[model samples]
Target: MKAIFLVPKDYKLTGGMYMPINHYVDYFNRNGMIVDEIIELPYHKDNTCKGISERLHSKLSEEKYNIVGFTLNICYMMLRDFQLHKNSNCDCTCFLVDSMSLNMDSVIRNESIGKEYIEHILKFFLYELKEKYCLRNCNKIVYVSSVDKQYVLKRFNRDILGDVFVVPNGIDLPNEVSDKLVRNENDIPTLGTLTGFSQETLNNNLYPFLYSIFPQIIKEFPDIRFVIAGRGASVEVEEKLSHLDNVDYIGEVEDLHDFYDKVDIVVTTVKKDCGLINRVLEAWAYRRLNIGFSKNFAAFEYAENGVHYLSADNEGEFVSAVEYAIKYPDKARIIRDNGYDLVKNKYSWGKSGEVFLDIIENK
Candidate 1:
């Protein structure tokens, strides 16, 4: 079998949509399907719609491929173009990283009304049209999580023409779990989290925790420290962090191993329920005790509340969870071990690849 992947021009090997797409390409090549080409479409550049359509059509028509895969996050226009100039015998599959409708809805509701908000509203309707087109035209739709799959189905009224499959995101596990330092009774405990620090993330995930939850946690464990690492900190974000005495705001971490090693507990502050939290998986892979809201963990159905990791919903619960982890280090270690085992056994690129390959071959 021969295949070709259509990806955004700005796609990288590690972040964003590239993670799953890279795994899928590797899996297909190893399993007798030759990935002959990975065509990078100039979606981000200022090209006319007709120009992009022509370029996509020309590239796709250059070779005869059994399968053509698309990363549907930002390439909705390409999908529409592909449908218009598709080969009758070739099959098409779309890989959705998350529900664009849900994400856009959240952004519009959260962001204040302004020029940016108007732009989002326009993009939201545009995405709606493209999403429906892809759903009605493609041969198969692949989702990173079941939560996203269900949301897309309900939003589109289950009017999809293609078969939908849930292929959860996987992690690249560390070679060995890092050794955590033994805490003396007088030593201060540390809590850590990482984010891109976008305006949306700051408002929805980090700022809420910093303002409402962290104060209560600080009241109980005054000696506890919070370590935050990620890029894109605006002046306002910097000012906000400066006011908090307990916060150690490291600008950006070059390697996550060091971040995981320094913290006693990993907290995922993402409030969105649409996609799988990579931090949760990373914490488990590094054998660190993770505390996150139950809703954030909803995408991974296999992860249990008390067995795998701690779950806290609101400020009071979150503060209490942090307090418990700090007080009873031994019990926290058990949860860390359990989470490590779950990730080791259930989450991997190979597993996700196998499922994707099965769907492609069987179809």
Candidate 2:
């Protein structure tokens, strides 16, 4: 079988989206399928729908591929292009890596943003409509997490549920988990997060909450330190966090494992219901105890509320969880061990490859 995968134009191979999609391509090829990846679609960053429409129609009209897969970002054009190739013998699948509906709902719920926010709602509504159409029409709908799959089922008609499938994101495990549970003979605990600095990241209200909650944590455990690392941190964000003595910002990092190795605990403060946060897997791989909201762990199968990692939903709970980890060293070590075992057995790239092969084969 021959297949083609469509990714958004200017899609950087850097973020969480790259690894999962790359795994899909490799899995298909290993199963005797010839897969061609096309990242030349002209819609995402460019709003010229008509030109993109014409080009996609022309491309699909020329040949019949056995399977045409679309990365979720370009779902708006998937169905329209597939319509042109309807005469050809091919199957269509959509891999929804992110939730457009949830994201739009997030923006719409905050009515204080004014007129432009309404425009964003209408625009996102069109994208949601297109996504629903593709989900209804496609041969298979692959979701990155079961949480998102359930979210779609609740929002859309019940009939499409059967077509939906879950193929969780995979990670490359580190060779060895850090054994340095204590901070250099001082025993001062350090917690950090490596996150992108964007409006979406800010919208989660995570960093700001941490900024507020950190002072509280340090009041009891005075030696604790919090490190924030990522790109796009505006001056405003930096100023807000600058007053705290225990807080530090390292900006963007080239070696994430080195960052992971240095920290005693990994903190994920995502406030939204979305795909599996990649940080959770990385934390487990590094044998670091992760403390964050339960929603961030919704994308994985092995994470139990108290088993794999410490769970916190709100600001108060998060502070308490960290305090508990700092006060009770034995419990923290247990969490780290459990998380390492879970990631080792179930979350590797090879295991994800087997899952994808079964998905494409209709198993």
Candidate 3:
């Protein structure tokens, strides 16, 4: 079967949306399906609509695909384009990687500083409305995590939501990278976190929270230094975080396993998400104990609360979890073993391939 996957834009080696494309393309291609990931859509840096509609419409004519899927982002043009194809009786499946609703919050974030700049996005509600209407009309909608599924379900009834499917993102066991987890007597314990600076967190709302939380974590375990790995830092975020004692900003890593290898613990501090995150799965593959907020269900699904991962509902709880993690070394070991077992048994990419094929065939 020929399957075409639509992403918000092309893969940039960094960003939250790239994970599903990377994971899915490998799985589908290996199983005798043509998986085409369309990454040409523009973003803030390149804000040109520039014939994207014609390009996607032309792609459909090039080949007869049995299924077409979408990877949702802050923008819904990718989602709407897929619906246009599906409406033409072109068999399709959509992966709403984020919430089902229009991204008003993201629209606000992508807004520019100038008077006419932000005004354009602010006045484009009808375009967002069109996207929302198209999503409601699509044949099948796949969610990256159960949290996403529930949020969409709660907001819009099944009557409005068509064939809704919830399949959490899967992880490969990382057999090849297993040998690379070499521990060195490094300068610090290497507590690490990854994600581009999403505009949501780039604001001043989160830095004070980090300041309050990190200092307490250090007092409990002085040997550990934090690595904020990713390309999301703005001039403000960089200035605030870079000079701080041991917080290292390793911008846009080529191989994430290298970052994971040096870390004693992986942290996911995402404040919101309905989908499963790729960060937790990477940690699970390396047998690193994950500690982070409970709101991110992707991590919550793989790393059981207090079992395969440590969870914190609040700032105080996060500090306490870290303290307990350092004091009890066995805790990390046990969680690591359990995390790998869970990934191997339930969340492998091979399993994803088999299930996805079934979805296309059955639909």
Candidate 4:
């Protein structure tokens, strides 16, 4: 079988969005199928509907693929204008990393009502309509997590004629486990988190943990440190972190492994219940103790509260979880080992590829 993937022009090889497409291409080619990727024109204010339709039509006509896949960001507007799924001969599939409606909802509920808030409300309605059109017309819909799939289904409420499949995000394991998991005699016990510096994450995840939760943790363990790393931060966030004594804010990391190695415990501060929790998976893959909010863990139904990793729902629980990790190092090692085993067994790129291939071929 032959397949083609349409991705946004700005898509990078790293990060959550590109992982599935990268693995799918490798998996299909290794299994004697031809797979290719096309970088679509960047969407901008100047691009017209006619131009998008013409470009997409020309591209589709150039190949005779059995499956044509589209990343949701690049194709949502195109799908609305061209109805490419109805016009094309091959099976059209829409790949969603997360539900845009849910993301916009998070911004509305959390962010202050201003220009950005009003803008998100407008986008919420736009995405709701376009997503409905794509889900109804496409032959198949692929979601990165069950949480996203169920949210879309419940939000739309209309009968979707297409087949829906959940293909969870996968990670690439390191060749050798780093020795950083073993703490030094004089090193400070540190807790770390990595996330994008978007306004939504800053308000919902980072600020809450830093302002509300971290102060309490500091009161209990005055010597402990916190490390933060991600893409970018606003001036206000940077100033706040600068004032904090032991909090080290590394602006952006070149490699995530280096960041994981520096911290003793990984805390995922995301409270939103949508999208795959990549930080939890990365901590597990690196063989480090992970503590995350109970709500965010809903993204991974297979992960248990006490078995796979520690769960904290409130400030008090989070403080206690950190305290437990510090006081009982041996027990924390056991939990980390369990988490490592879970990632090795279930969350590999090869495994995710096989499931995606099965959906494409058998479904």
* Candidates, ranked, TM-score: 4, 1, 2, 3
Backbone collisions counted per model? 0, 0, 4, 0
| Cα deviation of 46, candidate 1, in Å | 5.0
TM-score of each: 0.89, 0.87, 0.76, 0.90
For model 4, give the 10-residue run with minimal summed lDDT: 179-188
lDDT of 3 by residue, 100-210 (tens): 343343335544576744654664454446435545766577766666566556656643446666666676566654422213322234678776676555442245445
Clashing pairs in 4: none
Q: What lDDT, from 0 to 1, does candidate 1 have?
A: 0.76
Error of 4 at 340 (Å): 1.1
All candidates' lDDT scores? 0.76, 0.71, 0.62, 0.76
Error at 242, model 1, angstroms? 2.9
At residue 265, candidate 1 shows an lDDT of 82
TM-score of 1: 0.89
Which parts of model 3 are misplaced by more than 4 Å? 12-19, 29-32, 35-64, 72-89, 100-131, 158-161, 175-189, 204-209, 232-239, 298-303
Clashing pairs in 1: none
lDDT of 4: 0.76
**Candidate numbers sorted by lDDT from highest down:** 1, 4, 2, 3
Candidate with better TM-score, 3 vs 4:
4
Model 4 C-alpha lDDT per residue in residues 259-317, reported as the tens digit of each score:
88788888887866668888888888888888978867787777888777899878899
The reply for model 2, stretches above 4 Å from the true place, is 45-64, 81-85, 106-120, 158-162, 183-186
